[model samples]
Every structure is written in structure tokens, then in C-alpha cells.
Target: MNARLVVVAVGVGLSVAGCNVAGSRLPDPHLSGRDAQYMALVPTADVGAAYERYLVDFKTSEPPGSIVVDTKNKFLYFVEGGGKAIRYGVATGQEAYGWTGRATIGGMQEWPRWIPPKDMLERWPHLQPTADAGGLPGGPDNPLGSRALYLHEGGKDTLYRIHGTNEPDKIGQSVSSGCIRMRDIDAIDLYNRVKLGANVVVI
Candidate 1:
């Protein structure tokens, strides 16, 4: 090969390699929002087999103006009308299980505080003493990873939240205390689309 041609080919190869690396580092499609505090890059190894069964495609058929949570399937469906829905993987209550009801999103916050209930402390004695001390500060380490949507019924707090989790592996599993947990990126995306007072149906 000619010397000039060799140099040009080497440059092209380097450029292609760079593009591949950049594309590999791109965030998952289910995550949205520009704030770094609301985003987390979880390792695929940690997530392992938990979400292996979940369908990655968010598009579906369920209709608009309604939310459906299928705990058995570890999926949350947002009806988008016209026989369509957006499915997201989720984590459900582990200890205090089997919650099925109708509720509305009362409010939402970014990186909200976590106040452990007395019951929770009692159930896990190791969490006693400081469990009722008003809670943990919001951050990446908090159980409520990035965003939180407080649920309510008849204008009263239901003590449940549709929130984010630091444990990406927990997605598509029953592993939370009582709240509904989602991947950080997916939760932020849902938070942006859902309005306060929107209906949520857990089944």
C-alpha cells in the first residue's frame, strides 16, 4: 500500500474506534432529565439476572390517562392511548407485601429525604434508635435514589411512594420495604411525564 493511503486508513480506524466507545457510554433510553443528581450509571453485572426477563422496549398498548402496576410481572405500564403503553421495570415491596389499591400522586420531589417509619425500625431492630429521628438526607446513597412521587388517597398521605432506587438489580423484583421502586433513569423519565394528582393503580 502507498504510504499516504496507509496514514489515511489508520486515521479512519481511530475515528471509528472513538465513535464505538462513545456510543457504548451513552445512557439508557429509558432515563431522561439533565440533572446529574437524578441520574446514575449502574453496572450491568450488579443488575445481573434481576431484570433479564423484562422487555426493554417501552412502547406498548394500554391507552392514555392511566397507570398500571403489575407487581407479579415487575412492570409498570403507562397507558398512552390508541392501544399503546410504555412499560417500565420496577421493584416492589419485599417485607410488607401485597398492596393493591387506587391512589393519586400527591406531590413529587428530587432527591427527597427518607424518614424511616417506627414499624420499619421495629421490624429491623438494627435500624432502631435513629429510625424515627426524622430521616436520612437526600443523595445518591439514600434509598430514594433520585426522584419520588408521593402517593395519597382522599387527600391523605398513603405512606407509599413511586420512587427511584440505587439498586438497579432490584428492578423487576420484590425487594423494597413498601414503596414502589424504579431504576433511577426510568423514574426520572416517569416523573417528568406524570402530573401531580394523576391516578395510579397497583395490581
Candidate 2:
């Protein structure tokens, strides 16, 4: 097989954002804002009780609304002050596909579009690398799902994001390219709560 084909095959099996997930179910982007569509997209796969939304007793000096990604446990925590946090389940990068360090939520969007970076295309040359990368527009199958939080450091785009993913099975699994992937509901909730310029620590 050609390199492109090899990469494409790998992507389909290892990552869900390449528009090729096993037993895919994506709704029209227009309905993304709806909560019903999210539960329908993956009926059997729930992020589960451990990953459910809840306020937990926690200790953190950071003020509320701060985002913390505990990739080892596949959980994202939104600091809610007073020794409390709203925890959400997430799908982090697989193996060596993750990123770390500190950044701020420099920007946010609803039903945001996805444009595969050049490095992404280089690894998966089978992808168009243009047009569709940006053309995939925000929607149910858009990979970005209902919301996105762009992480930046020192006012510069770090290219890492906390966003929504449609692939349900990917939840709690190391299955993304790099960005932290949360369910549509969880993402929308985070999007609604996280303040712009909020500190994000991916540890």
C-alpha cells in the first residue's frame, strides 16, 4: 500500500477525526446544538458514571472556570471554586499523540469548523490537505462537534484544542490526534462555562 493508504488505514483505526470511524453515526451539523441528537448519536456508549458531570470535592488554588485535563485518567475538570469541580469525561490523544503544558483558552466557538493542519496532512496524505480540511464545516460529523476551545500560550495559538467529538467509542480511550475530545453535551457545557483566557493545564 502507498504511504497515504497506510496512514489512512492507521487513522481510521487509531483516530476518529479523519472522518473514518468504525460504525460512525453523525447528525447534520444544523442539529448539533440540540441535546437529543447527542444522546442519539451513540446510544450504547455513555461516558459512564465515572465520567458523568458532577461537582466533586477537590483542592485547587486556581479559581473557578479553569480547565484541567487529567489525560492519564481520561477526565477533564472545570474548576468551580470552593474545593469543588465539574468533571467531564474525555478522549485524549493516543500513546504519543498527546500534548502537555500550560495555555489559556484564547478563543472559543459553537459548532466550529475543522481545518486539518499541514502536519496532519503530511502524516495522512490521503486527506485532501485543503478544501475539505477547512470545508468540513461544523456539524454532527464535523469532528469538532458542537463546540471548540482553542488553547493558546502567550497570545499565540498553540494549535491544541479542547473540542467535541462525535465518535462515542473514543470516549475514555486514547483515540484523538492530539486535542482533548469531549462528548457534545460535555463540550457544550464546558463551552458555556469556560471563560476566555482561562488557564488550561494539560498534565
Candidate 3:
């Protein structure tokens, strides 16, 4: 698949910016009891007011329930129909490892295990043992955090994911391998909403 530049719809407006007009973080109703409990144990970083989750008046042609990722803006929009989307801050891939295209949500996992890919192990040989041993288990210290949405194309795994990150400070930055990274809270929220076979467009 080839990457193409997509122009965002014009006249787009934000419906609710950063929890409230004051930009303070608040408990989200989307979070479950388990999600809240997990969050309480993790050390979270502020990703700035601009990157906070919000409900926006999205003017996108994509159908409702589709995910549109604006890598340039470090935002991921979950289309909610009726000109609205739930926008969440995300951490994208670095320049050398960036990927953009369309894929379906082929699989989903809660507290996914992390197997450092072959390339990643080659880059950092010290991780080879973990990879050989069947990767790291999912937990508070796991890089995959609370949930993962696997992207696939044509019935094949793309090896890229939209997953929760242990490093919340990385949100709003392009510092990942090739996957999209979100805060644990945001990941859980998205994971709960997204279903298998849902469309994901990253650009």
C-alpha cells in the first residue's frame, strides 16, 4: 500500500476541548472500574492541553466508527457520526520508521504481551533473550500497557498496532517504532469502542 496525503475537511471545529475550557483533566465516563484502578497505579504525564482527548465537530468523509490518524498533528480521531469525533492524543512513529495506509482492526487484546520484533531485537541484541523466551508478559511495566488494537491488511498481520504505552510522556511525540501509541486510559477507551473489522486510516 502507498501512502497518500489526505486533506482534512474544512470548517472543522472542536466541540469540547481538553476535558473543559479550563484544560484540566477530569475522570472520563468511558473508563471502567478496572481502568480507573489501573490508572491509579501508573505514573502518568501531562501531554499538554492541546493533546488531551476531546469531542470535536469532525467533518470527515470516513464513515462513523472509522479511525483517522493525523500523524502530523499527533491526533487520532474516532469518527462518531453526525459531524463529531472523539479525538485522542497519540504518539506516532519517528521519521525513519513512519507508516501510513489503511488497514482493518484484525485483532484486539487486553493487556497484550510484547514480543520485540526481529528487527527490534537485531537493533538491541540484549532483548534477544526476551524474544527467544516468548516476549514480555502484559502488566503495568509492559510497554503494551492495557490494550492493543492490531492492524492488518488482506488477512495478513501488518505488525503495526494502535496500543497503550507505558511511557505516557511520549504522547504527542513521534518517537515510536512504527506503531501508534496512546495513553493507557485513552487506549482502553478506544479499545472498548473499536471492534474487529473496523477501518483504520493512518495518514
TM-score per candidate, chains pooled: 0.72, 0.78, 0.85
lDDT of 2 by residue, 101-166 (tens): 778999999878777776677777777655564557766777877789998877888787898887
Q: What is the lDDT of residue 108 in candidate 1?
A: 94
Order the candidate numbers by TM-score, best to worst.
Answer: 3, 2, 1
lDDT of 3 by residue, 1-203 (tens): 11222233422333333333233343564555756666777768988887777777677777789898888888898988998788889999888778887889999998899999877776789998998899898777888888999988778888889999999999989898888999998888888788799998887
Residue 40 in candidate 2, Cα distance off native in Å: 5.9
- Regions of model 1 farther than 4 Å from truth: 1-34, 37-63, 129-133
Backbone collision tally, model 2: 1
With a 3 Å backbone cut-off (N, CA, C), the pairs that clash in candidate 3 are none
Best candidate per lDDT, number?
3
Better-scoring candidate (TM-score), 1 or 3: 3
Relative to the true structure, candidate 1 has a C-alpha RMSD (angstroms) of 17.5
- How accurate locally, in lDDT, is each candidate? 0.62, 0.69, 0.79
The true-versus-predicted C-alpha distance at residue 170 of model 2, in Å, is 0.9
After the best TM-score superposition of candidate 1, give how far the Cα of residue 111 lies from its true spot, in angstroms: 0.6
**Collision count for each candidate, in order:** 10, 1, 0
* Candidates by lDDT, descending order: 3, 2, 1
Top candidate (TM-score):
3
Query: What's the TM for model 1?
Result: 0.72
Cα lDDT of model 1 by residue, 71-150, tens digit: 76676766555544456668887734546677788999987888776567666777654555667877777788778998
Instruction: Give the least accurate 10-residue stretch of model 3, judged by summed lDDT.
Output: 1-10
